[model samples]
Target chain A: MDKKLEPIVKTMQEKFSAAHEEFRGEVHVFVNPEQIVDALTVLRDEYKFELLSALTAVDYYPQTSPRFHVVYQLTSLANNVSVQVRVPVDGDSPKVPTAARVYATANWRERELLDMFGIEFEGHPDPRRILMPEETEGHPLRKDFPLGYEEPQFTFNFEEIDLRKPYVKE
Target chain B: MGVEQKLGNMGVVTTTLENMVNWSRTNAMWPMLFGLACCAIEMMSAQAPHYDMSRFGMELMRASPRQSDLMIVAGRVSKKMGPVLRRLYDQMPEPKWVIAMGDCASCGGVFNNYAIYQGVDEVVPVDVYVAGCPPRPEALIHGVLTVHEKVKAQKLKDLAKS
Candidate 1:
């Protein structure tokens, strides 16, 4: 955490004071769906947080209000500082603005987040499955999914492996 | 029935050739190192010190398909990587062995999702399947021993042919 980023942090805190009253220092203001892309753009162009290292989601199921938390970790190579931004969303129609325009790297990361947490990246160019198949019914990373599912083993012929054998008693 | 008769009646050269084959098979088992996911860490651990797999004669890890004799599919294989896995298997030299290292590689572990190839054996022929979430180092050693036994049996049969 450098002294130079203090102004950027303060500006962000002041701008989104309404939506993000629970803002901390290193873990910056966690905004809602509406301001996500704008905030990311400002962070990148204005503040020089050039690298969007990782975008992932954490499922908070069985809870009342927010069912998922999407986390975006950004790093500024010039300043050598990092910040984490989180946005909580409802499971039924979870949606967030795409950061693809701000950073090209967010394309696959957002798709993966969608695949695992079922969160929608609104306005994303090509939102598709990255890990799971296209027709996969449920997100396997979800806690609700069973870890181990029992199924029938594939049958194989054993007699084919015994071609050269003739019983020779010792 | 004494030493004189045993020396004179050395018939088929069975014992000598069988011993040589067993030694060669055990000495050089070149495993094709396949790292698919997280369990690859443990596979790497098995290769590193403390568990020093070099002692049992399987420390040589070949990156190329032509040179390697064994393939250790160390983690979960995604649907995308399935064809690649099969292609690598096809490229390897004959008389090759495959070891399915983790729960993911053996079977699709925690991911029952459509993306994963349920088990690597679905793509390639696996000789020994080491069982664990990521099988313990000792369990991997056991799988190595199992492969050794299969190799020894094959060698003896080959010797019997000549």
Candidate 2:
């Protein structure tokens, strides 16, 4: 863990009951999905972790207990340090409390997470898909989502494919 | 009297109306001023001073579809952009042509996925396909010449059908 972030991590762990682990000097603090907003608030207002660098979700499809880990990366310009906050969300329909209130940048980032991972954000001012086409059926970034490959037409299959290929007509 | 001296004031040359019409159409096949992705850069290069597409009578790239006769689909077509392409193609006047200007616009190139449409042909009828990741300006010129060849070959009766 970064030496500068030690006391801040200690405060977050002690006060919010956030458990933290360090990998090669970078620190990640885990908090409950519901308590994420409060944890981010305390880190921002008190510890000066002002910038919300990123907000994204990681999918663990087969693991139903905690299927998704919503990641929030915070950067403190004043203290010259960064910390990552992770919220483990469980079940098929994972829901996380909106962090938009605490960090203004979280608005679009959370919308992207919602679009790609289908993770619902409680109290999100506008809960709409940010990237994909409006009528796009599934969250494309999910593990179970289809790779969306189309079979390439090689010489052997060209004539066969051409016979059925839907070319636009006059 | 010599032939030149006798025919100084008047001369008679004969050609069919069909030949005249096709000749004019091939000369002034104004392409639409539009581009989608990276290939658009190459398309611009083809128009620029270095390669100069003006000699081919395509210097005027019209912004309005109603006035244009050719659409050089310059790059990949995303699913969101497919409908707009079709709408523009429909708005173009009769006897218009389409040149799918790159591998991406031709047969999806490397983007065989959900977001990008498999190929632009699924949206609008393509006349010539210049195959390249982003084809060289020479290749685009070649494609234009091919369209001219096609237009020249058309019979007068065929013009009525379009």
Candidate 3:
């Protein structure tokens, strides 16, 4: 960590007692779901991490205890530095406070997270599917979602495949 | 007047109605001005100065489906876009030809997942399949030529039957 980030990290540790790690020159802070907005706000207002670079989620499905990890990447134009903040939420009904209050960019990113992982942002301005169609049934990015593969046709199965191939009639 | 007098201007150019109709259709086929993905770039390049697709009488790419007789489906069709594509095909007048202009449009290319339709043929009948991730402009022109050949082989009586 740079000399400038040290004090911010120290303050964050004192305030939230959040676990912090340094990897690839970027600080990673693990915060409770409730403290995500506070941590991000402090990083933005106090530490000069002005930009909300990205807000996305990772699905660690089948591990039901904490199934989703909502990640926020913050960049400081003044300090010329960046940090990642991660908040883990339960699988059964994954919910996190909207970071939109801190970063306006969080609105669409949270919608994408909700669309892909079925994670909910409690105070999201417009909580709807961002990428997938409105009628899409399941969160496609989740590990449990099927790949929906279609068997490839080979010479051996050519005749059978030909018969099964769907063709539109005139 | 001298040449007409010398030749008598009496020669009859006799040909079957099918041959005349098919020849005209093949020579003046107009393609739709629609593109889906990366392959669309190649399609535009084919229409550009270098490849010069206008040489085949395909100079005008009509934006409206009603005026176009050929649809060059130039990329992968997602499940969402599939119905839209079918609707566009439906809007086009009869005797329209569809060219599946890339590996994706022909057989979903590398994206055989749930999102992309396996092939565009599922929605509309394809007259030609141009093979490439994004086929070269020359290859697309060749596909167009192939459609021309198919058109030339059609019988007028068959059109009536359909």
Candidate 4:
């Protein structure tokens, strides 16, 4: 693990019983979804990880136990060190405590996670769809979300497509 | 100067109203100053001194749709932007022409997804499709000239029918 991240990882493991792994000189400390806000608050207030550089999620399809891993990459601008906090989320209507109180940037990042991965951030202020249009239905980043496509209009079916295609009548 | 000298004392220069109207419309078409994406850069270059869009009598791009006679859709149209594009198209006066000035505006290019409207034609009628991933300034000039040609061929009787 990176020299700067080691102490923080050790501290998280000791205090919250969070599991951690080190790879390629970087550390990932996995905390329970319910304890995410507390963990993030501790990191920000005590460890000086004031900047939430990124808060995104990864979908792990076929892994029902925990279908998503919401990642929070925190940076300590004063110390020039960055650490990652991960919260594993199960697929069935997964919810996690909001870290907005800990980091202001988490507000928009968490909204994006809600929009893309369908992860609910409890206690998030002004929670709304961030990226996608207001009427968009599914969480686009989810594995089951359809990658909508258009049918190529070849010469053979060009006439057929013209009939069904939603071109402006005027 | 030359026309005056040629006319001499025979001061009658008679022409049909249709010919006069079409000629004036083709000479001074005001395209709306709207740029959606990268293709807009090429469109600007076309308007700049190097390509000199003024030679075709397009002195200035109208900032408002009400004043413009043509719209050059110069980039990808996102779903969110579709309604806005349609609203602007509706605001433009009749006899206005649309030139879909890039692959994205013409047929959604490679962004064949839900986020991007498949083609701007789904929102407004396109008079011409200039095929390029942001075509060169020369290509845009050619598209503008093509629109002029289309205007020239338009029949007054057809305008009345519409």
Interface RMSD of each: 11.3, 2.5, 2.7, 2.5
- Flag clash pairs in model 4: none
Going through the candidates in order, what is chain B's TM-score? Answer: 0.83, 0.92, 0.93, 0.93
Complex DockQ per candidate: 0.10, 0.50, 0.50, 0.55
**DockQ, model 1, C-alpha based:** 0.10
- Where does candidate 2 clash, by residue pair? none
In terms of lDDT, the poorest run of 10 residues in model 1 chain B is B10-19
Q: Which tens-of-lDDT digit does each residue in B1-162 have in candidate 1?
A: 234457887554444666666668667888877677766777788889978788887788888989998888888898678878889989997777888888888767877765676777677777888889878888888898898988777655654574
Which is superior by TM-score, 1 or 3?
3
Number of the candidate with higher DockQ, 2 or 4:
4
What residue runs in model 4 are displaced by over 4 Å at the alpha carbon? Answer: A166-170, B1-12
With candidate 1 superimposed using the best TM-score fit, by how many Å does residue A66's alpha carbon deviate from the native? 5.1
Question: Which parts of model 3 are misplaced by more than 4 Å?
Answer: A168-170, B1-12
**Best first by DockQ, ranked:** 4, 3, 2, 1
Proportion of true contacts reproduced by candidate 3: 0.49
TM per model? 0.61, 0.88, 0.92, 0.91
* Candidate order (lDDT): 2, 4, 3, 1
* Highest lDDT model number: 2
Clashing pairs in 3: none
**lDDT accuracy of residue A91 in candidate 1:** 74
How displaced is residue B137 in candidate 3, in Å?
A: 0.9
Clashes of each: 0, 0, 0, 0
